[model samples]
Target: MKRKLLVTAFLLGALLLAAYPMFSVAASSGDVGGLIAESDINPRAARTVESYSLESSHPYSNNFDYTWTITEPGATQIRVHFTKIDVENNYDYVYVYDYAGSQLHKLTGLYSSGGWTAWSYGESIKVRLDTDYSVTDWGFAIDQIEYEGGGGGGGSETNVLTDGVTSSSSLAATGDTEMWTIEVEADALSMHSVLTCGSADFDLYGRLGAEPTTSTYDWRGYTSGGEDVTFDNPGAGTWYI
Candidate 1:
């Protein structure tokens, strides 16, 4: 399939300042990439490394998966700062996870602000990149910072997600789906979600008060550009996407 591919790299941990600690890795098989561990880049109560870059194999390499991991057993909080990012809007993206492997956040062109920043909630961090055979971009680059004693962690919260308020995730390629949970107020007028960001093509699916799957979705939206999936007075409990 001849596709307009976009090429870019991911947070594979590249040394910015000399003597700075970092690591990098790449994977071409399966949906998830193997974790790249580097002699424990997490420091304890000491200023060891500055930043790490997660780069891709090459621009528009078609399909590939890359993974990067940072573990600070001492709860050494980590912060990620995005420098240059352009991931085909949403068709390609990097998913970030907390120390406990929770979906902390995901990034695409829609969420890219002037060097956006995110922090980890646990003692470790995992960044994985999944790309498609379609459009590509210059991927993304992030700087890693560690704080000792879990204090001064640099507002290191990476999840900018809000239920109906305004949050988004990405599906890197075909058969790629991003799932998350959101809270809906009691008997609210309506609870909704939208494809407010990203270029390419993506379908939005939701399951009110249930888990979302490609087949079990209660509400589905396959429209292009600013696709909005709204539910009138949805259940007051938790909703799946």
Candidate 2:
């Protein structure tokens, strides 16, 4: 009886651990929506403000009026999906700003004709409305701007990686290597690079100067073709140019 009880407890714990990952993945994948504030809108005549209807196939089908605002900019990403299609063919716009009202990015494009379309901004400081259009009897939807980070660690500007040298042909080749260049910059943090091949297996290396020097880092594993690869920052360090 004692042995049976122990086995059951062990099985339950394993099941719980497996269940956690499944739940997390499901939660991360889904649709999100919300309102926009009046202040974030750019004062340009080219800007068209419309109401967002998450349920409508055409969220901005007609002239709808409303005002909304976002308190935090760096933490929001505005998105809009269209539901209706007409000869007018207006496009949905998404904008972002920092806490100080600095423009971050803007995306303007037409939504899917009859399918669900989405746009997103990772971290923003605040957002505001661009129009006073009231939306009634429309099928448009607006999602609450959610924040998506580039992934773990600090922003790309601060982290740098220097993988040691292997060979010129070792980097991933879509077809040509001349199109590639090593780039780096600073924002809130630094970032580094790790290369992966898309067609052939290759080794990746990094260094600290315009040319390969005495110091370098090699990838622990080789990436295969058609594999999505990521070059993560191995903390803050000097990288080859």
Each candidate's number of clashing pairs is 24, 60
Q: Write the per-residue lDDT of candidate 1 for residues 125-185, one digit (tens) a residue.
A: 7666777888766665555455344423342222212322334344444655444454344
Worst 10 residues of 1 by lDDT: 9-18
lDDT values, one for every candidate: 0.49, 0.27
Segments of candidate 2 deviating more than 4 angstroms: 1-67, 72-94, 113-140, 144-241
lDDT of 1: 0.49
Quote model 1's TM-score: 0.39
